[model samples]
Target: MEKLDHIDLAILKTLQENGRISNADLADRIGLSASSCSRRLDILEKSGVISGYHARVSHKALDYKMIVIVHISLSGQFAKTLAEFEAAVKRVPNVLVCYLMSGEYDYILRIACKDLEDYERIHRDWLSALPHVVKINSSFALREIIDRPNLAASLGS
Candidate 1:
């Protein structure tokens, strides 16, 4: 990765706030010429720094009302078991995020559902049936206080 100068950081910060901001406006805001801004942005995108632009969609709007935090302990820590578990997890639609961890549990998952009934179905069908899963602990999130998607990008090194 290339070193990000102040201008690059400024561009990143602006883009993080509003991905749809026009190039000219972004250039003006970051104190760069239009051509320079465009070139820099192109470089950033091509180099995989600026991955993709997307809109923030609400899960509640999509009728996913409950967020379940799940802690999973696998049957074993073997490479094959872990790989199979991760692959199976990706196939489940309700699983929003999964993370391999270094703690009491092997993996943690964030699952979204419409309600308790929906979560129960997912738990019975998906969670229980997951490959090599030995134990599953789940907790419901009462409310989402904060959900920042671009914290890393905004706080550049």
Candidate 2:
């Protein structure tokens, strides 16, 4: 991919703020003609700079009141073991985000539930069933201070 210039950066910033913005408005914002802006967007998409867009939904409104962060340490870090664990996690509905990290724990998962009982079911039925799980620790969120994915903006678009 080519290095992004100021216009590309501006385009990314605008799209992140409002993904539904029309091409004409985007051109207006970035001081370009509609066709030129459309071409840039096409190139951005083709080059994989712009992956996709999604709407942010309120979990509270959906009655998903509990947030749990699960830290997992595996018995081993073999490729097969990690892949199996991740694939199982994908099948579990409550699991929202999972990250493989370096440090004391092998993996971290962010989960949502309706309440403590719901969490218990996930702990017992879903998470606990995984093989080669050496240690499992869970922390329930008391309050959500800041919750945004904090999408990349400083990467020069």
Candidate 3:
């Protein structure tokens, strides 16, 4: 990947603010011709800098009222054990994000569900059954202070 120029940074910053912005509008904002902007955008996508566009949907609107932070300690840190755990966690419906961490816990997961009852069902049916899991600690979020889905823009700025 080539080093991004000022124009490239401007394009990224603008796109991060509004992913749905039309190419013509984006060009106008970034002081470039539509053709030039389109070319740069194409390069950004092709080079995997701009991975993909997505809608930021509300979890509340989807009836997911609770976010559970789960810390999991695995029985073993072997490759096979980690892989098996990851594969199983991917299949779990309520699991929003799973991270393999270098801490006391082997893995940490962010889960979304309707309520306590819903989370209980998910825990009983899926989370507890995950491979190599020796310890599971769960914490319920009372409120969300802030959730930034756009961090790449900060880098450009």
Candidate 4:
């Protein structure tokens, strides 16, 4: 990867705050010409520094009122076993995120559901049926303190 200079960092920081900002607006904010800003943005996208733009939706609006954090232990740590488990888990609808961990648990999952009854159904039908899953521990989140989609500090904002 190429080293990002001050201007590149500025562009990234600005985009992180508003992904949908127009090229003219962004250029004005960054003190660059519209064409220059557009060229820089193209380079950023081509280099994979700017991955994608997406809307941040409210889970509650979608009727997902409960957030469940699940810790899972697999029967084995072999690559085949882990790959099978990951592939299977991806097919589970309520699973929002899954991470392969380095601690006691092999994987950790963040799930969204309507309520306890909905979670119960997912736990019984989907989670328990995942391949090679030996243990599952779940905890409900009371409230979300913070969720940052951008890396402001890392970008030197």
Candidate 5:
């Protein structure tokens, strides 16, 4: 991948603020011609620096009121066991994020549900179906203290 410079950073920042912004407006904001700005953005996209654009949706507005953070420990650490666990987790629609981490737990997953009863159903059916899972610890988030969608782009320089 190509190294990004100040101009690239500016383009990234502008895009993050308004992904739907027209190329003409973006060029004006970045002090470049429309064609040059378009070319730079295309290069960024082709190089994998710009993955894709998305609209940030409000979870609360969508009636998703609960967030569950689950720390999971697998019984075995083989390749097959890991793959099976990941594949099962990927099939669950409510699971928002999953991370493999260094701790007592092998995997941590973020799950969304309507309430405690909804979570109980998910735990009984989905979480329990994964392979080699021995322990599952859960914590409920009372509130989102800080959340930002354009985190990576904001860090660019």
Candidate 6:
């Protein structure tokens, strides 16, 4: 990971806002020549700083109307148990994100579903069937307040 200089930071900030921005436009916005901007962008991509570009889509647009936050407590924290749990979670299609936590809960999952009935089905069929799970607590998100995929704030402006 190379240290980000001023130009690199500016490039990252601009790209974060609009990944589809043309190279020439990006260069103009950041006060860099097109060739210089292209080189820097190439370096950024090669170094894994600019992982990939993507279109942000609303879950609701895809018929997923509910977001559920689930906290899972495992009966044990053995390596095999954790591995099995993680692998099993990956097989579940509606589990958007899963994290191993350090506190009271063993794992936290963000799940998307169509409705309460769909969530109930997931809870009964998938979450409960996971190995080593002792308890599962779930809460529905009323609404999404903020969801930013950019890390521009870490660059210190």
Could you give candidate 3's per-residue lDDT for residues 24-124 as a string of tens digits?
A: 99999999999999999999999998999998889899999999999999999999999999999999998989999997999999999999999999999
Tell me which of candidates 3 and 5 scores higher on TM-score: 3
For candidate 4, the TM-score is 0.93
Query: In each prediction, how many residue pairs overlap at the backbone (N, C-alpha, C within less than 3 A)?
Result: 0, 0, 0, 0, 0, 0
- The candidates, ranked best first by TM-score, are 3, 4, 1, 5, 6, 2
Residue lDDT tens for model 5, 1-157 = 6778888888888888889999999999999999999999999999989999998877778788999999999988898999989888899898989998887899999988899998999999989888899999999999999776665566654
Q: What is the lDDT of candidate 3?
A: 0.93
Which of 2 and 5 is the better model by TM-score?
A: 5
lDDT of 4 by residue, 1-157 (tens): 5888888899888887788899999999999999999999899999998888888889999999999999999999999999999999999999989999998999999999999999999999999999999999999999999877777526663
- Look at candidate 2 and give me any clashing residue pairs: none
lDDT for residue 4 in candidate 2, whole number 0-100: 85
Question: Against the true structure, what is each candidate's TM-score?
Answer: 0.93, 0.92, 0.95, 0.93, 0.93, 0.93
On residues 4-123, what C-alpha lDDT tens digit does candidate 1 reach at each position? 888888898899888899999999999989999999999999999889998888899999999999999998999999999999999999998999999899999999999999999999
Better of 2 and 5 by lDDT: 2
Worst 10 residues of 4 by lDDT: 148-157
lDDT of each: 0.92, 0.90, 0.93, 0.92, 0.89, 0.93
Once superposed on the true structure, which residue ranges of model 1 sit more than 4 Å away at CA? 152-157
Model 2 poorest ten-residue lDDT run = 148-157
| Root-mean-square deviation of candidate 4 | 1.4
- Could you tell me which 10 consecutive residues in candidate 5 have the lowest summed lDDT? 148-157
Number of the top TM-score candidate = 3
Give the alpha carbon lDDT tens digit for every residue of 29-99 in model 2.
99999999999999999999898888888888899999999999998899999998888888989889999
